[model samples]
Structures are given as structure tokens and as C-alpha cells.
Target: MKRFQVFAIIILTGAMLLVASCFWPKDNIVVGERIIRFIPKEEILDFKVKDNTQNVDSVIAMLESRAYGINEKAIRRNSILDESVFSESDYFVNPKSDGGGTALDNFFRYLQKSDSSLIRIGHFGDSQIEGDRITSLLRIMFQDKFGGSGVGYVPLDDVTSPVSYTRSSSPNWVRYTVFHNRSAKGLYCPGGTVFRYRFATPESTRDSIGSNGDTIKIKVPACSYSNATVFLKLFRGYSVAKLWYGKATEPAELKVYNSKTNELLAEVVLDSDDPFNVMKLPLKSNPVTLKFVFTGPSPEIYGLSFDPVVGVQFDNYGLRGHSGDGLLTISSDLLKAELIKLNDKLVILQFGGNVTPYVKNEASLNNIKNSYDRLYQHFRKAMPDASVLVIGVNDVARSVGGTYASYPMVSRIRDAQKEVALKNGCAFFDLYQLMGGENSVLAWNKKGWASRDGHYSDKGREIVVNELYLAIMGEYNKFLIHGTTAGK
Candidate 1:
């Protein structure tokens, strides 16, 4: 009896182990354990037979049934060229410069000679960059390398997730979706503004230069929404002074005799209730910590440009579920305004993560291309001097044949993006290919880099950052070489 019991126990233990192995949850999937196995799409060959005419129909039907909606033929060949070619004035007009080489490099080359304190970067996308997923990492990296401060153009009030900038309270705000052309006017506390928020209160800060004197010189950034009013307030025993403004406003030139002996304060304000509202503030004061304020009605504001900087940095204008088309239709004027500020600036267009799952046919693929083309056209019109860089869709996962497969539509989108980028004098980055071609998401999941909670895990984001950082760095290096050698 004891020997029989021991045998049964051993068998039971073995069965339990098998069950546990079979029921384990996938690393990055939100599905339950039993449905989380890695069943390759190729292994699920469950097609059927029929008559001759039915046979062709069957094949097409089967392919479509298996998520083969991608128009493999629609993809264009890569045409981006080396930065050296961009130096020729004729090269700029050449139809071919529109594609190929790293898009990031093309944009940077435009800013190499600019006197701005920081180069401005805009990362527009769907849900990926929300809460600073990809944009935050890019900001830290870029700002560290370049010189800038203040989280660039964040919405006045954020409801979807907590922004890294100033926190908000009260639910009485209204929300608007640039994608659907919908506004939460009737709803309670929409929590979003249709326009950029501009502050009116004067902001004070210590002069980077020793403020032993009364006058400080500052420059106003070349920005959109030039129609703005800045209010300078004197504080901390600081007296009021005559204010001057300019694209190159300098605080060092302020005329004050022994004014530095007494404490003085200055308040600057750029007032606007429209989107794309950006203005620069230039002030001169004694070397003390300064306070800067922007006062406004109902919390509508825009971009603030400070003196002593040559370039603008990261501006987080990412909207959830935004298809990049909303701006074209809903806020064309505002977008145009923003583009004006960015004239001769760098525009990084990041998208494709949201459209991958919805693509179903060639028509859909073409439609997406057209949509992007429109978006690109508007951007071009707004910032004719700036360069545009379109990043192909990143690696993402989809369920196929009862298991997740790296959707092939990603490639189709990349191809489409490349074609569009090249056609419009823009640059393209094959983000999907950069992340390891097909099914890289699976590796990310298996390696525990991604979380099973749907969105990318923190680890997964880091991995993405690593790859993107390399790509951007390489592109920047190319710009340096070409700018020094070719004069592009």
C-alpha cells in the first residue's frame, strides 16, 4: 500500500508541473494564463478546399482571415541619401532628397547655424508618448545634450494621466479631442483646453550673469502667436523700469544709473488664448533669483520664450488616440502658428503605433498614406523653412492564430511612410526595422523587457530608448560631418 501511494503521488506531482507550465501567462499580454501560449501563425494552417472558382476565393479569404490585410506590394523602396548630398543648393530642390537618410539628421542640419539657445523638438503621436513614455526619455536625453529648461508646451490641464510638469486640481475643466472634432463644453470640467495656456503673472529669476547692475539684456524667441503682452513686475524691494523687447532682447543693455544698488524686480507676460501661441520674454535685472509670472483668464496660455537661449527644446504636444489628422482639420490655424515659430526648425513626426491594429486592406493602407500626406502638407505650409522627419511605426504585437504575431502591417506602414517622406522633401526612420525587424515585440516580451499589462513595461521603454538613442546619435553625427565638410 505504501509503495502504491508513493507512485500515485509522483504521478500527481508531475501532472501539476505540466499544468502550471501550460497555464503560465505571457509576459506582456493582458490575457489570462490559458490563452497566453506562443502559437506561431505559420503552424496554424487550417485552410479548406472547394471548387475551382471557389479556390481562388478561398485563398484570398483565408489570407484575409489570417490577418494578411497588408498590401505587401504597396511599400516603396528606401531612397534617403547621405547628408553630404543635402549641401548642394540644387540638392535641396532635388526631388530625391525627400527620402532615405536618417530623418533626424536632416532636421538637425537645418539648425546647425541658428543662434537659438535650444533646438525645439516636437514628438506627436498616439498613446505611446502619453505620460511621457517615449517623449520624456527623449527630452531628458536631448535636454541633457542641448541647453533648455521648463517642460516645453504642455497642455494647461491634463486629465488622461499625470504630466511631469505642474500638477492640476479641480474637475471643472472642459476637454477637447483634436481627432474627433469633439469638445466637452457641456460636460463638467472637461479638463483640457482647445488653446495653449499662457500665464500673465511676472516670473522672476536670478540673472545668469552677475546682476551687480540694474539693467539686464535678454532675447525673445522667434515664436508663433506674436500678438502677446508681457507684464513685468518689480519685487523684493526692486523698482519698476522701462522695458524693451526684441528677437534678440538683451538685459545687459538696460539703462539704469546705480539702479543695481536698490533691489528691483521685473515681470513679463505673453497673453494669448489661442493654440500655437508662443512668445519670448527678455529681461535685465540685478543678479538675484528672479520670479516670472504669466496671468490669464480661464487658464488659456501658450509657449514662453526666455532670453539667453538660442534654441527651443522638447514640446510635448502628444494627444491620446491622435491620428495626426486632427490638427489638419480641427486646429489648422493653431498648427500653422506653431509651425511659424518652428520655421527653419526640426519637426519629428512619430506615429503608426495606433494604426497597425486597424489596417485591413489595400484601401486602408492607401487611406493612411493619404492622411499622412495631408498632415505633411499642412506642416510644410506652416514651416516652409523647417525639415520634417517621419519615423516609421515601431514594433508592436497583435493576436494571430490564437497567439500574438508581429503584425506585418507594420512593414507596410513603414514603406508608405518612406514614400510620403521622400515625396515631400522629408526624411524617414524605419523604427520597426531598427528594433529588430519582424516579431521583435515577442522577444521583448519573452525577455521580460515588456510587461503583460498591455502598454510597454518600464523595462521595455528603456530598451526602445536605447535603440532610438543610437539611431538619433548616429544621425546627429552624420549631420556634424556633413555640415563641416559639405556646407549643407
Candidate 2:
């Protein structure tokens, strides 16, 4: 109860600050007209949080541990892949294909072919995916099974980039996103955020409030957003590092150095050839402390991808406090410009938890379906080649009298989500059902896998994503067995 009071006090304090602030965007969290956006930590706060080695090695062990069902020793390869005969977690319902193959045939085929090409899976979601919780495990599993390395596609200024690596940017670097700043003029990367040096124009900003410890920064003007340096501390190194960006108005100096030793690794003069540009650096040494110094002109810095020449890479784009509706504002041209060049295969859309608290009537329910359908059409136009999978809203619990229970409207939203996925020829995964339906979160909380707030704890996420992995592999197994699900 004291923790609740402290949080409430913080909220009240933020609200007071929001009232005084001249300008702020209403993107992510909207609580009774005040923005309750959970801001990402700036690189300056890097020392505050511990990192290095929590993801890769640890996650690999969990994957092989036989957590949910099949044991690695008994299954070897065939038993784990035998979803039809062995696995019980079957919530994935895919979009109908053109009759010859299933919707994910192209994705599965790529996995089967053993190509060295990087298979990109963009996982888009709400706060549930922040801090690279669920997606990190997926990256390690895919990379281990198929072959790949490095965390893929992190925003230039990320609040939840990935705990696997430690990153700090110059405080002058301010972030603009589809949900964050409405007045800022810039296109968003797949992560829903684009960054600029402090020089960029803006009305006002809400920098990470109180997250820097006890002090809430209510007003930060356009000229000076932060004061920090750019450096990446990798727990594990990658052979290839690719930096993605939009056009630069002038040539910029992007020099790479070993942050600890200050030894120059590579130096490059950057100017975009087209609307989108990527600078691939072949690292000879995996420096423990790598620093990036960008000077001169600020490009529309999208994010960086650390991957090998071959295997699968999954990018986590978590847009907090949003229903899936925010995609309507994301420009298709911008998305295509950044993504069209990649060997993109699958796009996972996980959402609807943020919308549960707002459901009051039937109109709100229809809004969910309509917005999703529109977003689907827009996303398809943006990246037409990729297979789309919609993971329905997970179970949401609310306080009733004293104890917590499932919200009455969760099933309605899940139904709408399933409908949208089916209607649009997108694959559907019934996360609500997989979570054991209504009030399952209560049980999850009992097991320390869930909180009353609806987000999954670390242990719970491992199990949640484990099922998702099996479901995808199950389809692949069928593909391997049947050859094709397309019409004859």
C-alpha cells in the first residue's frame, strides 16, 4: 500500500508539472487529458542500471531447459519441431493464403532454405514489449537455431533499447516519435521514433520524468534537451554493425572509437545517397567500450542493427500506452523507405492491453476493429511482402472490491482483434486464450509471472514467448511435412 501511495504521489507530482508546462505531445499515455508517457532512460543514466550478459547466454539455457513442455534431451530436433504430435500450445491461427500455401509460407521457406541472408522480424507492440523483454529471447532462439548475432534495430534514443547492451547518447540528442511529439517534423523509423541533436526545433518536451532519480524535468526547451555522450558497452560483440538513417542535409562526422581506450576503430563521412541510408561497419575487434561521435549535421537517425552476415534478426518496437490505433499516423512512405531495403519476412503486431481500461461501450469496441483493419491495410501497403501476425490482447485484470479479476471487456477486444486478423488475411495468435482466458492473470500473479498492472515479469515472459515460438515452429513443421498449404 505504501508503494501504491508513492506511485500515486509521483503521478500527482507529474500532473502538477504537466499543468505548468507550455507544450507536450499527447501520443503514448493519455490519462484524463494529462500525458502519462513512460519515458525511456537517457544514456546518462546508464550507470544507474546494471547490464552486460543477462540476455544471450542466460536465455539460451532457458530455451533448452524444457520449460513449458518438450525436453531438449528427449526431443533432440524432431520432437521439438513436432507441434502436431507433441506440443500442446496451439493458439496461432494464420491468415488464409491464395490456396497453394499458408500465409507464412515465405517466412518458413526462408528458414528451411538455410540461406545466410538476415531474416528480419519486426515485433511491434505496446509497453508489454518494452526493455526488450519478450523479443530478446526470440532473437537468441532464432539466432541459435538458424544462426545470427547482435541485437537488431534499436532507436537512436531509446528508453528500452535492450538491456543486453549499455548505450548512452549526448544529452543534446532529443527523441521525436509518432506518439511523443506531434509538433516535431520528422519521419519515424519502424521503432516509431526518430532522433535529432538538441538543435532540432520543437515547442517543448517532457524528458524522462523522475526516472533520473527524484527530480521530474517538466520543461526542457528545444535547444538543449540533454547533456550526455554516445557510447555502447556490448556484453557480447557482433561482427557487423549497420547504422540506418534518413537523408542528411550536410555531411556528418561519425567516428567510432574504443570508449575505454579511446582507440579509433573506424571513421566515416556520412551523407545519405537516398531518402534512407545505411552505413555498415565491419568490426575487426569487439571492443568492450565503443563510442560514436557524431558532429556537423544531424541526420534523421533511425537506429542501429548489430547482426551477422547470416541468420534471423528480430527488432523490437515497443510504443508504450497506445492502442494499435497510432499506426494510422505513421507514414507509409517513411516505413517503406527504411524497411524496403531489408530482407524482411515477418511482422508481429502485439497490442490491445492499453485499450482495455478505456472500453465503456459498444462504439469503443467497434473502434478497435475499424482502427486495426485500417492499420493492417496501411501496414500492408508499407511492407507488402512481409507475413503479418496479430497477437490478440493478453488477459487484463482489474481490482473488484478487494481482489483482482479479469476486465469484463477483454474478451470483446480479443474477439475484435481475431476478427480483424481473419478479415484482413493476417495470421492470428489468441494470446488471451493461451494465457488461460478470463482471470488467468490472477493465476499468473500467483506464480509471480504477472502483476496487477498487466505486464509480465521476467519468468512469465519466458513462458509466454516459449508458447509463441512453439506455435510458429508448429506451422513450420506442417510446412515441412506437407510441402505447401497453398491451393493445388
Candidate 3:
């Protein structure tokens, strides 16, 4: 009898706990650092095909319509060098704004007159391009068609994974940027970040300069190019710099190795008295690792650019958590100096994704719009000759009632971005609409094209980039045919 009574009490306790768990105060509960949410009991397990098929169909039709006038056979014959194959308009420009010409027109002009000078495109984005995924592919596409050699700008300290190049540095190196580190104050260049290497002890007390300084190794993959130019933008307080190339296990000594044959190519000593210096080295072949050993006062290194004399150089200036507002923080003089050095012809701003989640109402939306306006104005004032292109936010979905749906405020944020672009005489690309509006992320997730809530999978990225390429080339082709006679 006593055993039966104890069993009844145990069942009652279990029932009580289950009932309490189901009746929480909020829909989502915070346990530790993670938010635990209750799933709806009647959630749909299977994917429901939303009625947005027309959106994608319309995009395809637009691409097809743009290809109607071109000679398909001739394009096929010389597709490698032909830009017409990619001509399709996926961008919008304001009807009444006088920045003079379209960004695409400016870029086309640069492409035509790139023999004497190098034309550079600065692609600034957030985590969408963290590992050089999108930027590297774009670089290859541009370089292949535009007759350029060498990888473009690489930051002094790589914060994200690199696809084309491998960079490893000593542990003593420190990174400073305009975004994250509040205490770090100074004039940042167009890249918005810089790296510095300092000795633990005073340089005077160091036993040996080579033994105490930091060493950085950059390995380039094998390719047809046999020469590379290292462009360095230096800040104050730099003395002697040594560059060694070739296969060497030791980091203390400088060894000359053949850049082509991977044999010790050459040894060069650099003096850091100027703000900017370009060091050119002849490589025996591609696939070479260059080691830079520096010892002296700490030097603020902007970036190391490897590029040929004349070609399209796409510089990836991606800052992980920036909302495009940080550009205003950089002094205009410093920003213009770097842009002038690069001969920046086009500036692509890929933001809005980082600022989407916090936009709850009209006030928040206005704040973002104002911030973008300031950023656009800053870029315009700094680079009057350069064109600006703003890419809108991608589709981000959150779980609602156990099913993934687009955030309610995404459209508002995108509209705000469009307003800012129009107001600043900039071109706007609707990434959200291009991805397929309204629950498109859910469809992408269903098809395994999205990795998580909103981030694209490899396949998804390829699709989006292909479309973007078509859009850019399409506009460029229109500019070629119309020759600025038509309104933007």
C-alpha cells in the first residue's frame, strides 16, 4: 500500500513539471546566453511553395529580353573577351539627380582608358564577403576580361579567411580599426583598418633587430604572372624593412630566391621615410611566398597590394560589423589621399544587412537613412570623380509560429536605402528583390541554398553573383550603346 502511494506521488510530480514547462511567461525564454523558444505544436513540417514564383520568372524574362538585340552566335564565338554577354539592367538610378553620369558609365570610361593608369574598384561590405568568397570571384572575372595581373589589396592583418592568398603572421602583431576598438583613434585610410608591429622592449635594448621583430609570410598560388609589386601605405614611426622571398625555413635571415622557380629570388631593403612606397620584385614564376621582417618603431601599415601596372584592381574593403556609418568617421583628407592613390573609379557599398534587425519603426528607419546619407555624401565629397553604388540588404527571415518568414521590417529598410541612394545621386541594387521577395529566404532554406537563417550557401552565392554580374555588365553595355545620350 505504501509503495502504491509513493508511485502516485511521483506521477503527480512529473505531471506538474511538464505542465509548468509548457506555461512559460514569455514565448522565448533566456537560458544562460542562448534564447530558448517554444515551438508551436501545429507547425508545418513540410515546405509550402509560396506564390512568389512570378518574381523569379520575371527576373529571368528580363535577362532574356536584354539579350534579344545581341548576336548570340558572335557572342558565343568570343565570349571570353566579350562584355555584351553580361549586359542586363538590374540597377536603378534616380531620374533627377546630377552627379553628372552613372557609376556604370564612369566604370566603363575607366575600362576604356585603363592603358596609362590602373583603375580600381573598392567593394566595401560586411560578413557577406568575409572570406573573400564574392570578392575573389569578382576579381577573377574582372581580371580575366580586363587584362590585369596579380591579386589586389590585401589587409596587413587578415581578420577573415582568405581564398586566393595565405597569410600568417607572428603573434606579436596588433590590429587597429575604426569600427571595433574605440580607444584606437587616428586618421584611418580608405580601407578603415591598419596593422602595427611593435617590439616588447625598447629597440635600443634589443639584442638583435631581426631576432626581436615580427615576421609575416604571404604565399601566392601558382599562376602565369611572374612579377608582383608590393604597395605599402605607411604611417608615422617606421625605420628599416627587409623583404625576403624564396624557400627558407629560417625567419631571422633574408634569403634571395627565384620568384618563378621558388628559388631564392632577390633580397631588397626598404626605407620607410615616405607615406607611400611601391616595391616591385620579379618572380621566377607564380606561387611564391614573400616574408617581410620589420624592426624599428611601430609602423601603422595600411595594406599590401599586389597588382600589375595597368589593369582592373578590385580592392575588398570589408569590415565585419560596420553599417556603412563608419565611413563618416574617417577624415576626408586621409580618405581622399588613399582613394587618389588607388585611382578609385567605382565604389560599391554593400551594407544594410547589419542594420536590418534593429529597425523596429519609422524612427529607427529614419536613423539608418540619415546615416547612409552622411556616408554617401562623404564618399561623394572625397571622390567626386568616382561613382557610388549601394547594394540593398538581403532577405533575412526569422522563425514565426514555427515557420520561417521574412522579417516584417526588411522592406522598410530596403526602401530607406533606396531613398538615401536617390538623394545622393547614387545607383541602387535591390538585393532583396533580386533574391526573390517575400519568404524567399524560406524557399532558399528549403532548397538547401541557405546555410542558416539568412546567409547564402555556396550555390546560392553563385546564383546571386551571376545575376549581379549580368546586371552590372548590362548597364555597362547600355552605356556603350547610348553613350550618355539617354537619361540615367
Candidate 4:
């Protein structure tokens, strides 16, 4: 065909496609885990995605220069990074009504004189903060200043390898969670997980020898008679340590040993049939590594805590793909009991982002907001004295002809979050606005802070954590200056 004939054919095809776009369905199609959108004629020409990243390498490069220098004798820098990102989000949404708008007041007051008290902060969210991505840094930011040692809570089978320490369990242990099945039973741990172990007996190789000088081989039963061990290495000194487990249906023996020295730390016989129990280890010195050996019928190990009775600790209980409403799965009484026992002081909830795809319109958004409100109400009942901090969803990008922009419903979600938070007497942090409003995800992706315009990268988490630290410190400083009436 001639060049003019080819050009005419291409133009005709393009025109046909453009005209046919008008008939496409307006509603987004949901496929498995993705929302497929069909573009209409009106939005066919808009290429609005912008590069919004800022180069702050020089200003924040020195943030994560070193690791947390943990020492029980002396106070060191709280965290590796102490610099602020100077984000557009300047303050939290704590409204005043009749001079009673103190949202984070309880938490701030605790931080003011935290030297003698136990302050536990629970950082709960979806995969964004998984594997201790965001909570580890925040724990560092507060622990040294508040006088704490040890990592907070380590579940029996922490699907994500944590950042602060190493935890290895026996292969025979089975893990269960409420994320996939919201109506899951049993007393779930704060991490939304629970572990079960079939009782095992030690290999009787030494005892299998016969008196007639005959040698016999013994095969340890995989399910009922194999030695299973749980190993923990903190790499640093921790003044306190404890283990949490469920009812000991049968008599079991737990032997705690110092892996480095082979020294026997403690041996306990667990036969109590209580629904829950705490085994506090007797640590003579700040040991770095320990091993747990289980023999006989084992109880359900809920989680472990390597923390002090007095100081600050943040537990990372991130549930991937959770919409903040999954907390209802765990028995409310059990949940409240766990929080009260932990002495939980603050609960920082980072949600909305995970559920945005499910919310397409006003009713869905409102449903999410109501869900969050219910979540906070449950939390209040669980930890009456604890303060809750609601972080609005960060910017999420949607493409329009290759132009990426914030989801249209993001602002509405943020507004709903703020409104509900203030109404429920919880502190609200406008994280969506904090990242420069609309194109923030794109900007973060441009700076390599977030991967795929959503999940945060290392640099992305750092800047975000830095901003949060600055915000918390800002409020704490005000509390220091103005006392409890700072809001006035």
C-alpha cells in the first residue's frame, strides 16, 4: 500500500476507537484483586500525572547513619535520625470544644514523665508497616529517651522477619491468623496471629541401649516426639524478657538457655490450665542470645516480649491487607485483657490505604469510616486509658492516559477519617495532606521513596517516620512548656 493509503487507514482506526470509548461502562470492573477502569471520551486527552518528588538527599542523608546504640547504663540518642522532613502537614487534627479537645493528651502526658512508668505503644496497620518497617524506627525514636531496653512483642510465627532482632522457631509449629478469615476463633495475639505446637518427646537414643549389649535405633516421632526449639537473638543488651502462652492443657517442660554460653537460664514446668500465662525469664546480665527448648505436651505460645517494666516499647502488629476492621475477629474480652496486661498506652493506627480499592463511592467510603469508628470504640473499651492516633491514608495514584494523580476519593476518605477521629476523641494525623496533598505518591515514587506509587521504600519510610517523630516531638515539647492545658 502507498504511504498516503497507510496513513488514512491508521487515522480511521484511531477515530473509530475514540468514538467507541463513549459506550464503555462507567462503573469500574472488579477483577480478583484489581479494579479495572474503562476510560470515557471526556477523559481521553488528559495526561495529568506529574513528577512531584523533591531531592532532599543533602538534608536527610545523615538521618540513618548508624544503628540504635542500646545500653542499660547510659542514655544514648533515641534514634538514628533526628532531623525533620519539614512536610506540608504541620499539625494533627485535634479540635477543641469547650476547652476539652485533648486527643493525644493522655499519651503526651505519659511521655512527659515517662522515666518511672511503662509506656507501651502499639503500631497497627497493614503491610505498609509490616516487618517492622515503620515501627522499628519509631521505637528507636522513643526508647532511649524514655529509658527502655529490649524489642517489644515477637509472635510465635512472625511471618515477616523483624528488623530489630532474630527469632527462629521450630518447623513443627503451625501459624494461624485472622486476616484471611475474619471470624477466626481462639484468643488471637496482638499481632492477629496464634501458634500451635504438637507435644514432642526427646529422642531416646541414649536410653534405647539394651542391657544385653544390643544396640537399638529409635526414631523420634515427627508429630509427637521430636525436640523442638525456639531461638532468639537480640544482638544487644535487654534488661527484661518474658514469654506469653495459652493454657497448658498437659504438663510440659520449658528450658531456657543462653545460646552463647550454654548456661542454663531457667527451667520451668508448665502444667497450669489457665487460659493465659506469662513466663518471666530471670536474666542475670544483659545477654544477647537465648534458646527455648520444649518437651512434652506444649501449650499454645501466643507471643514473647523482650522489654522492661518501665520505659517505652512499640509493638509492630501489622496485618497485611487488613482494613482495620479485622480486629473484631479476636474475642473482645481476650483482646481487651491482652491490652490491659501489656499496659498499652498509645495505639497508632495506619489504615484507609489498604481499603481504598474496595471503596468506590460515597456509601462505601462512609462504610469504611463507620468501620474505623467502631474499631476505635472497641479499642477504647479495651484500653480505656490508652490514646489512639489515626493516621489518614497517604496519597494513592491512579493513572489517566499515563498521567498519574491522587485517587479522587482520597480527600473524602481523609476528611471522613478526621471527622470520625475527632468525634471519637482520637487524635488524627493528616498523612494524606502531609505528603503534599494530591500528587504526593508520584513525588515519593520519583524520589524512590515508594515502590509502584504505593508501597513505601526505605527512603519513603524514613521521611515519613521522620515527619511523624517531629510531629510527636512538637506536641511533646508543647506539653513540656504548657503542661496539660496546652490546648487552651
Q: Give the TM-score of candidate 2.
A: 0.79
lDDT of each: 0.49, 0.71, 0.62, 0.71
Candidate 4 Cα deviation (angstroms), residue 137: 0.8
User: Which has the better lDDT: candidate 1, or candidate 3?
Assistant: 3
Clashes of 1: 69
The CA root-mean-square deviation of candidate 1, after full C-alpha superposition on the true structure, stands at 17.7
Query: What TM-score, over all chains together, does every model reach?
Result: 0.57, 0.79, 0.73, 0.76
Best by TM-score: 2
At residue 53, candidate 1 shows an lDDT of 23
Candidate 2 lowest-lDDT run of ten: 49-58
> Which residue segments of model 4 deviate by more than 4 Å?
1-89, 96-101, 181-184, 199-225
lDDT of 2 at 446: 58
**Cα lDDT over the full model 1:** 0.49
- Residue 59, model 1: lDDT of 28
lDDT (tens digit, per residue) of candidate 4 on 250-362: 88777888999988888778776765666787755557788888777767677778887677988888877777887777667887777777777898888888777667898
Could you give the C-alpha RMSD of every candidate to the true structure, in order shown? 17.7, 11.0, 11.3, 11.1
Residue 456, model 3: Cα distance from true site in angstroms = 2.3
Q: Report the lDDT tens digits of candidate 3 across residue range 1-488.
A: 34567679999976675566567555577888999765433333335433333345555444334432334354321124355355345454523336555555666777766666678888888878765667777776676656566667677565776665766665556667777763264645575776655444222222222332433343433332112223222211111122211111222222334333445545544444444434454443333355544444344556556675776777788888878787777878767776886689888888877887789888998898889889888887888776788888888876665455677889888888888787787778888887667666766665666743567777677666666665666666555655641435
> Among all windows of ten consecutive residues in candidate 4, which has the lowest summed lDDT?
79-88
